[model samples]
Target: MNTTTEDTDDRARRSIGARRNPASQEAILDAAEAVLEESGIGGFSIEAVARRARAGKPTIYRWWPNRTLLMLDVYRRFKNARGFPDTGSVRGDLIALLQNHLLGFWKDSLCGTVYRAIIVEAQNDPDAAKALYAYQEERKKATEVIIERAKARGEVAKDVDGRLIIDMVVSFAWHQLLINRLDEAMGSIEGVVDGVLMGCAGYKR
Candidate 1:
């Protein structure tokens, strides 16, 4: 019944990951986020997260396949903080959503840097791109929910194509991100949201 030193090391590595302790898992994510916020992606490393969370790097790596995968968790946390705006007016809701995104991208230091890092990683990593695009699809579905809500409230035509609306929004946001023109993008959100909604709300005679 003798256990080798290697067996002991293996058990230690698997213990945290295999036990499935929610608190420990959450702490790791929290630490990762804190590192990003304080130092951006430049300072985010396995050793840093391990130190901040007071857990071994092996434990963190076991849960997430790589740094990119772990970053997805961080991105999800911040994105979830601001849910779809439901301000009764479809136009108002969209304007609000656009404004928040623009401001976050331009004014929020932590958010801007972290998102930029993720986008850059997506450019080179197929797995990262897949995760990011899948998340984008999820968001598109969420936007459709807002569209449905608008229809329920009689603010939009029942025939509105939610997917088209989502495409427009996504394109505008990325255009701003790519061009580094947050000011213009922020100024144009109202116009863009209103103009597109014209079709959704139907033409008035």
Candidate 2:
């Protein structure tokens, strides 16, 4: 009778553990981000993340095979938090977008650290570089759609290259975020819009 009760209790415990494992996976990812921020990518390891998450290394390896992929998960979490904004007008929209990006980079230490690590990893890892490129392309598509809407409304010039302008806008913002502090970065929506219009517009107001 004692042995049977012990087996039943063990089974119950395993069942509860199984139920909570998914949530644990999320916790592990969160902990991984913290570790990455505290130690940087150079120091990140599966064992370290497990220690931070308070789970075994097997639990982490079950979900993410490597630290790079795990960091990607952290990046995805940050990206999801800052949903894309659609402010109606191109000028307003561009400004809002840049402001949100700068704010995220400056305010969110985990995100800032992850972004820096990804930039470094992309230099050597082709897979990491491809993932970053894909993320950028998706963002470009969103901006391109807005630019098309503006062109249709006669708000922007028809001859302007949407892709080129998008590249310019992103390049400038990235430069500001990477080189200077967000506060010091010259990322005014009005300024970007004005500069773009000066080059692209046929008529001046």
Candidate 3:
């Protein structure tokens, strides 16, 4: 077989395109965020992202098998951009998390819309439901770490399961998001945190 220089260059380009490039991936993510922000979830699609990113549809699909996975990645980026609370106490941390991160992030038009769409999408799509569940499992692990810290300080009861507390708080936030009441819930976040604390510590208050 005679291999020409042009043939070698063609193969090299194909190889590069077949593998993921960090810069290209970042560009695609950036484009996805922009598309969602400008068009909302209703307008978000793989084709739209590909057009905005100036990448091929195959590239996007190669990196993310479906819209659910791509959307989750976009949501994860929004979250990873922010810092998690570490207020030295579980109560303080929970309150800060609600006030500073969860509520604040959900209050954003882009983040809130993406999350709400994901939840609604999950109800009808098995793949979306799976992706959401898997994503939340990772979040639960993070919550476990916070609980462990509280346990070390004797702030939480020995028998209390941290997952339950986090689930409660997260459920509250999701309800607020669904009801379009994130702003309203912000005022009551401290009380909510305290209630969860009471459960964890068995306090009379």
Highest lDDT scorer:
3
Q: Write the per-residue lDDT of candidate 1 for residues 1-205, one digit (tens) a residue.
A: 3766676556545544433355566777889988887877888888888888777788788777678878888877777877777788888878877777544444455666566677889999998899889888888888777788888998778998878887887778777776777666787887788788764455677
Q: What tens digits encode model 3's per-residue C-alpha lDDT throughout 103-154?
A: 8788854788788888988899988899999999998778677788999999
Q: Put the candidates in lDDT order, highest first.
A: 3, 1, 2
* Candidate 2 lDDT: 0.70
**Candidate with better TM-score, 2 vs 3:** 3
Query: 1 or 2: which has the higher lDDT?
Result: 1
> Which candidate has the highest TM-score of all?
3
**Candidate 2 deviation (Cα RMSD):** 7.2
- Model 1 residue 45 CA deviation (Å) reads 1.5
Model 2 scores a TM of 0.69
Model 3 compared with the native: what TM-score?
0.85
**Model 2 ranges off by over 4 Å:** 1-25, 37-43, 54-65, 102-104, 157-160, 186-189, 200-205
TM-score of each: 0.82, 0.69, 0.85
Enumerate residue pairs that collide in model 2. Answer: none
